[model samples]
Target: MRIEVNGTPRDIAAATVADALSELGWGEARVATALNGDFLPAASRPMQALRDGDRLEVLAPMQGG
Candidate 1:
């Protein structure tokens, strides 16, 4: 399946958000995620199913305030 991640097109074979994260090498990284412009909680990633053409956004925290 193909999904947009952070504005980039990516082809991935994943069933859930967690699977996508793992495939993107973010399995254990702390980050914020939104699917199709909706916020997706960390706890729900494991069950959040993804489909083709879904837009996913992942943002990692940065400290410097």
Candidate 2:
């Protein structure tokens, strides 16, 4: 499957958010994910379903000043 992730086009191998993270080898690493311009809570991430053309924004946290 394919979708636009953070404005970049890419191919993903998962149907849901949890599966997608697993497929991408991403763990609980402070990655903030917003689906289609909407912020998704951590609880919903496990069951969130992603569709074609869905926009996903996964960003790492920034630390230090």
Candidate 3:
């Protein structure tokens, strides 16, 4: 399936949000996501599903303090 990931087009086979993150090689500790412009809570990661043209944004934590 093709979904817009962080405003970029990418092909991924993931039935759920958690699967998508796994396909992206990202671990839960390093990324945050918003699906179609809605902020998804970490606890809901297991239930969120991606659709075609869905805008999935990944906000990586910045380490600067």
Candidate 4:
């Protein structure tokens, strides 16, 4: 299936948010995710289903002084 990741189109074989993260190499990374403009909690990621044309935004924390 194809979905938009951080504004870029990507083809993934994951059916859920958690799997997608893993497929995208973000399984163990601390990041924030939003689906279709709604915030998705870590606990809910496992249950969050993904669909074609869906927009997924992933943002990682940046440390600066």
TM of each candidate vs. truth: 0.97, 0.85, 0.87, 0.98
Error of 1 at 45 (Å): 0.3
**Cα lDDT tens digits for candidate 4, 1-65:** 99999999999999999999999999999999999999999999999999999999999999998
Q: Name the candidate, 1 or 2, with the larger TM-score value.
A: 1
Alpha-carbon local distance difference test for all models:
0.97, 0.82, 0.83, 0.98
Off by over 4 Å in 2: none
> Candidate 3 residues 1-65, lDDT tens each?
89988889999989788888888887555677899998887779788877877778889889888
Best by lDDT: 4
Top candidate by TM-score: 4
Q: Please, what are the lDDT tens digits per residue for candidate 2 over residues 25-64? A: 7755668889999988778998899898888888878989
lDDT of 1 by residue, 5-60 (tens): 99999999999999999999999999999999999999999999999999999999
Sort the predicted structures by TM-score, highest score first: 4, 1, 3, 2
> How many clashing residue pairs are found in candidate 4?
0
Extract clashing residue pairs from model 2.
none
* lDDT score for candidate 1 against the true structure: 0.97
